[model samples]
Target: MVRQFVSSGSTFETQMGYSRAVVAGDWVFVSGTTGFDYSTMTISDDIGEQTRQAFANIAAALEQAGSRLDEVVRVTYVLPDGGLFEQCWPAMRDAFASARPAAMMIEAGLASPEMKIEIEVTALKGSAA
Candidate 1:
């Protein structure tokens, strides 16, 4: 099987020596994605907007890997502030409620102060990988 590398042009991706996602066979492993609009390189101050953008970014990565949000089997979320759970959950539930992928939430600081939330997902497509 050939290993595929994916990048979203996020500075950390190159600097840290990792792709935004990797595809091998039928599995797509997405890296921890922060809530920033790569097109504009901006993060919204509002947690809701940031949460939504983070999922959007994850979805884009999945698309790049020949998968979609509905194919995601697992997800993990990291937050700089645990208190923001209320702010994050609604958006998350809204995004994944239909797909209902197994998910976990944890508290941790991101690389930058401006980053409040980061999300990662694992998707399975086909039955090869």
Candidate 2:
């Protein structure tokens, strides 16, 4: 078996001593991904938009690791405020509506003040990338 690191154009991972995602054999373990738009380096104040971006970020990382969102086996969400919990589900459902991976949502402050949602996912591939 071998190990590989996956990153999707964000500075935080290196600064935080973490990779965006890691692939070991047939498994890809993605780190908690925030809602920043990597292309613009911007995060929205809206929780719904934040949740959408988080999934987009996670999806990008999974693709880089030679996997897809549909391949995700599990997901964990970190929310700064439970108040916004209701607002996040629609976006979550749309992103993973077909996949429906086992998931959990918990309260936690994200890395930045503007970040309202963060997501981490695990995906399995049939073979190494």
Give the root-mean-square deviation of each candidate in angstroms. Answer: 2.4, 2.6
Candidate 1: stretches off by over 4 Å:
126-129
Segments in model 2 whose C-alpha atoms lie over 4 Å from true places = 126-129
Compared with the true structure, what per-residue lDDT tens digits does model 2 show for residues 1-129?
888999886777778888999999889999988888888878888989988888888888988998988888899988889788999989988888667888999998876788888898898885322
Q: Which candidate gets the maximum TM-score versus the true structure? A: 2
Whole-model lDDT, model 1: 0.86
Cα misplacement distance, residue 90 of candidate 1 (Å): 2.5
Q: Please list the C-alpha lDDT of all candidates, in the order they appear.
A: 0.86, 0.86
Collision count of model 2: 0
Error of 1 at 60 (Å): 0.9
For every model shown, what is its TM-score relative to the native structure? 0.91, 0.92
